[model samples]
Target: MLVKNISVVAAFVASVCIMPAQAQNNTIVVKANQLKADIQPTMWGVFFEDINMSADGGIYAELVKNRSFEFLKPLAGWTFKGKERKEGDLLILNRQDKQTNNPRFIQVNPNHTAKGDFGIINEGFRGMGIKQGLRYDFSMLYRQPAAGVKVHVELLNAKNEVIGKTTISPVATGKEWRKLEASLEATATEPKGTLAVWFEGSGQMDLDMISLFPGDTWKGRKGGMRADMVQMLADLKPGFLRFPGGCIVEGYDLSQRYQWKKTIGPIEERQLLINRWNFEFAHRPTPDYFQTFGLGFFEYFQLAEDIGAEPLPILNCGMACQFNTAEMVPLDQLDPYVQDALDLIEFANGDASTKWGKVRAQMGHPEPFNLKLLGIGNENWGPQYIDRLQVFTKAIKEKYPKMQLITSAGTDPDGERFDYLNGQLRKMNADIIDEHYYRRPEWFLQNAARYDNYDRNGSKVFAGEYAAQSDKTVSIHNKNNWRAALAEASFMTGLERNADVVVMASYAPLFAHVDGWQWTPDMIWIDNLHVVGTPNYYVQKMFSTNRGTHIVPILKNNAPLAGQDSLYASASVDKTTNELIIKLVNVSANGLQQEIKLDGVSKLSGNARHYVMKASGLDVENSLKEPLAIVPVEEQWKASGKSLKVNLAPHSVNVIRVKHLDLVSFKKAGKME
Candidate 1:
């Protein structure tokens, strides 16, 4: 009769249907299933630096030269005393000398006989489009005959109006070069402008290696990415990464685009481009700028390999109307774009025989990279986009039939855009469809079940960009409210439930330095002084870290609990250690105390490991000043006989691991005891 009762329970679980809550009493009972746990790596994606903007004199993503100065142009009253050399047709700056005679002052002097009119006119730092309210760290080397030089700095807006001004007193010594630094705060009154480094006030000073940066702090523990940053990300054990995106792919023009080729090789040849958010311009006449592709396609692919992640590269889509989208290249003129696609593949999976593949080998690795997925473009739609996508799809499929292709269609839930594009993609046999979402926390929670009924027969899904808003201003120190935590948790549960369809997912705008951020409420916020991970980052880590490879069926028996709206459970058994891993999610405002009874297992033994995620309140958040306001904690659980009872805090997620004792012989153990 007991066995018969268990069979009936299994049948009931198979027929369980999910429905919306009518009343508050929503509860479910779960029965353990005997299945092996399949452990897989976690998926955690972030954006690497894109070379679309210039931060300081040194290009972003490019290597910093220890001591050197690259002249942009000749100043108004300055003449080049040295010969200019031409490498090919390009004019190269070699070396120039300034002839001045009025008692050349090496350092600044408050009371001097002359006004130091011999200063280099226009021989100053140019802005790379820095805007107001953003923070930046500016550093340079000042060498003079004596110390005590007053360096004047000015930030000029696009209108040529001085928006910010500051003066620094250099710690001078007459004998050697001294390092000087000043932190600049962009003001609301300052529009997008250029930065100028003025060495005025009666001093003959030699300036070199002028560096400016935005963000609260540097990324790696040391100044640059030597080994610390790599170790930190590796410790997380992420499964997959979606490289190079979140508006960095969408440039203002073709000339300003992120050309992957330029970022490779040495740093000197790479040109710096204007940042889109900084509201600054390149040299004037036209807004077109150069990007020193220091962090190129190879680096992105290598980073994925180093971190044990599956690389998912996103290509440039058809041009936008604002940035001058190239007309659908006539079928005849499509060679260039098509060739680019081919080159990208070769670079990723080509052998030494191939051109780009040979380059990869020359870069140090002789083995071909494993690349199974390729994204057609960034966020794009419309008829023109569709047509261009078709061309790319045909070419890529013809070359590599087994390769997976991912495409983007606009995300308009209310309208038929996603549905319509989904249909088209299915018809064309696309492997995956990239979907993005950025909304308020309430909306995310309200639609947590949006993918529950998604067509299983359609292409796989990828949530490319989804973030809860905190602030719209440029400052990166803003904190994410507590409501966001609850909302994100609920939405993630939905993603986990639909893992079969949602094959891959990632959060957008992964990092922002307090001084140089264009967006707010990022996952990781850093400044020149410190770095902190947001509450959302921890939530993602906990969920991804505990995920198993395969899905198992669970049986729940609870009827209805007061103040509870939904209850769910998933379980798996680790083969190596013979431990049962169980995850329980309760989306209720009140706490839940339930007893889990395992009837079939007679060999169950050992302590249980439990991990929990919860918050003190709904509106709490971790600020720059206080980053660990909310995080996950681990504890042990007591198990007696075949039943385990545990208490779950309100609005909490819990994972428990129960060890087994099949390896221990009862008779032998009893004799020993």
Candidate 2:
């Protein structure tokens, strides 16, 4: 049944429908002869930010928090276990002057005691997730004055019950630190778990880089990413992976900003920095949060390569976060920052003979990462950013002129800030301007024609970060609901329609942990062991997996079908597959019958494939227990002639792909049979 107040009928009909209301048909005519533009491969991607435990406890497989004893409290995530603490039994020793990179270590002097009588317990980020019958690998760096100390490790479930155990003995006692390793198998599955280390002998020893990782990691790399979580990203087949972060790129202040050079090399030597999100939200304070750099820049590039995506890294523009400090570096003192940007390109793509490139080679990747895109700022705006960007651009262009630079247009997509930056950047001939949007659902519908009036020859656009908000932006109550997802779908049609102007697009704040997230409405939500893609994730996957090579015109009554009668659509043709890809979005609460006509095709198969995603209501969502609550439901569709009729479900997003069998029309478009 159609909505009583709407007429998606004779007004937008194909071939002038003189028929009555009962005979009204939904028709979208695909102009096979009209090719608007070619779609770039980097049209859709995933934006990564190290928020909500996305690194330490979320994706990075390390289970031990404060592994290097580098947090503000040094032992914020660790607790003393067993008998009253003896004097000097555990001491956080700082050698800041000598070991600036990793200045902290724990010294333990245990009395003669049996195993399980004394030690420390590490409460993982939230709690370590353990699985039944899975092996837990533990390793640490240690130094002993004399060799008499032995260590016992235990894995505990959420109930604090021991489920796995192993022991290690250190014999190479000397001035130099030695590494020790052990493994244990868990006997039960638990979402919240802990790791306890017990001492068994009387000896003086020092420990650092204490860690534990599951045997089941991505590709079984000893110290790698979570397999289940990485698989979710691989499933989307994203075109690019934007790394290191949103606000992390621009720290709370310059001193706290993310420095990529400090993140690579031996894991222990990599200096740790406090994660900006640790103190951002007063409502959700996480004082223990910090960047271990275990998942550093090299790992990011490797992950992008593993999933067949281009690497796009963002660098700071010598300015701190505007909302936090708004601190700007002096123009004369910006050399180091500018040099950092220059060195990154060399690190990513320069030859091994180069300094930074040699460092990249030592980390195990000799071949260049083929870096093509670099963003200058996170959300900084005004003449200050422009001034800093100019210096970096002038230096980088002189050295690496071919590199494409992505400039910021501020936090909001449109405002005095955005307008000022947009005009200035365009005047300067910037390559790509990044635009972000986190607004209500109504805003999405209203701006569906945003890029329609953009200059066709100006700097290209990158919808760098955008998501339709169910509640106010940054509110704790915001949800990843169908209403927001559906609105995003309707707006995305405009992006696809303007593919010539928009080269790259991605949703922001990609992953969130259920127990630790400070922000809501993330694309994917994770618990200890399970991962669930929200309604928004499925919507992005549908558009990405079906994005064709070239855009084709899809019209209704000689006008672009955008928010007309509550309908939005875009069409494309895959030259390689010789198939027509059509996307239709129906935001109304009533089903509308659609008749799609292949205008130039004299003969074509009526059979097609329909991928439909619809939920019972806008507020319905997916949870860990019901991960597939809103996934795309695939159906085999068949009609009889040139027109195919599909019933667009109430508040649904649909994708239809049909093979063009007409040789004449196919050859006319330069596509073979």
Candidate 3:
């Protein structure tokens, strides 16, 4: 049935009804020849933050928990047992002076002479997932004071039966730490398996950084990211990846900030720190949460390279998280923090002869990553941030003038703090300004034209971290539902329409473990064995994969079609493929029967394809049990001449791609035929 709202119909007729032959003004006219602006290649991207167990337990893929024995409770994830007794066998040793960052290591001391197999069993993050025939790499740092000390490693199933086993014998009786490595092939598949290490010797031994990794990691490198999670990101073909962010870049305190230098280098040597989200929320208190830096700066850059994305790494400014400690590094002692930014650029794009570049080469990636963009801070505000940012920009531009820096505009999209920072950034002539928004679905829907009047000549905008909140910001009840995703899609059409002003955008908190999450509504959610892409993920994928080169004017009647009869539209043409990609969003609860008229184009081929993502209900969500519940549905479409009637489903995002054929050339070819 046609929508009968008087205001809506009149608005549609006043804008869309161009030809008198058509009685109703229900057509969307797209000016194929009128190029509006050039679409940015990095307009759509993904933001990754370490909140919600995203790194350690979600995507980094290390199977051992508390690997460095650095958790507040050193043996939080491990259970000790002796062959005869279960008491006072395992001890945590700490060396405050030598290993300040990693001060603790587990030491196993049997009854001095009566030990069959006394060791500790580790319950991995929720439990390790083991598959038959797959190889698992196990490594640990060990030191023995006496000879004949052996460490027996085994992968055990849920039923307490061993599926894989390896042994590491420390023959040298010295205090020097020696690295032990072994690989175990599982004989059976188990989704919630555990790792057991038994020490059967007459001597005491110390171990630290007990680690296990799947051999089939992304790029097949040991101590690498999970293959499945990275593969999901790679499939999106994102133009850029914004990494190590949200609040993590600005730690709860200055000392806890995300230090790129500490995150790089060897995995074992990387300092372990308590994650800010460990006790942030009362609803989900994860005391075991910590940053092992296993998925550090190098891995983030590597992941970006593997996925064909430009690396946009955000560094910490002098000011810490404003909501927490709001600590600030003294201006006199801020050289080291600024130096980290300079060194990071070298590590990413410098030659092997450079100091930082040598570290990158030693890590096995000899080639530079060709870094172009760097973010100065996460969501910082106030004069302190501005002072620090001024120093950073002056120093960085002095060295690398061509490098683009993204400055922050506080947290809220439109407030006193945001206004102050935004104005200051513009006055400072910053290359790009990053803005974040975590608002309600209705707010997103209403703000579709937020940037329509932005100053195009000023610094470009980066919708750095944004996700439509279904319930409330940081609320446990907030969900990644179709409602939020649909609203975001609508808002994104506006962003694409003003592509010249909005250079880059990404969704926040990219990954979340279903059971270990501190934040809700992440793009992707995972469990012990399965990964699920939320409706928001598909929406982002649709916009990114189909993003064309240049924008074409798409109008309903004489006005831009933004929230007209609950419809939003944007069209762009790909110079490479000569294809017109038109995106449409129907926010209304009822279906839309709209005719799209192509103008100024002499001919358009009948060949077309429509990629759509719609959910049955607004509150519906995708889960590991039903991962495809809200995924894209592709269908072949045909257009006659320059007009096509499209039936857009309720609350849906559609990308329609049609071949733009040259009519004059086609006619000449037809005459020869």
Write down the lDDT that model 1 would get.
0.54
Pick the winner on lDDT between candidates 2 and 3.
Answer: 2
* lDDT (10s digit) by residue, model 2, range 1-673: 1231134322221212222446444677887645677889999888999998898889999999999888889888999988888788899999888899999999989989787777999999788889999998999999998888899999998778999998888885688898899899999998889999999899888999999999999999999999999998998889999988899989999999989888889888888898989999999888888899999998999899999898999998999999999998999999999999999999999889999999999989999999999989889999999999999889999999999999999999887999999999999999999999999887777677678778878999999999988888989999898888988998899899888888899998899999888887799999888999999999999999998988887877666767665688888888888788889988777777877877766667657889999998878889888888898988986644666778888888999888754534532332210
Relative to the unseen true structure, what is the Cα RMSD of model 3? Answer: 5.2
lDDT per residue as tens, model 3, 8-111: 33432233321233344788987776667778878988889898788998789899999988888888899875556545567888988997778899887665
| Candidate 1 vs. true structure, TM-score | 0.67
Clashes of 2: 1
Candidate number with the higher lDDT (1 or 3): 3
lDDT of 1 by residue, 1-673 (tens): 2332233223222322222334333223323343322333433454444322222222231122222333232122122221232232112233334311111112222323222222221222222345467555666665667654566665556675656567787765575656777767766443234555544444445554445555322242112232323443455566776766644455555554445565554333444444444443222221222233445567667767887778877766544323334433355566676667778888889999989888889876778778887777666665666777788888888998887887886644435777677777777777888887766654555555566567666787777677765443233443565556555665665565555567776766665555455555666655422346677777666666666554333444332111123444555444556665666655455666676666345655678888887777656777667878877789986665766788777666677777763422111111000
The order by descending TM-score is 2, 3, 1
Q: Cα lDDT for residue 174, model 1?
A: 70
Prediction RMSDs, each to the true structure:
11.9, 4.2, 5.2
TM-score of model 2 (CA atoms): 0.95
Question: Highest lDDT: which candidate?
Answer: 2
Give residue 493's lDDT in candidate 3 (0 to 100): 93
Candidate 1 residue 261 C-alpha distance from true site, Å? 1.8
**What stretches of model 1 exceed 4 Å from their correct place?**
1-28, 31-44, 47-232, 280-292, 321-332, 412-414, 470-479, 554-580, 585-587, 597-603, 640-643, 661-673
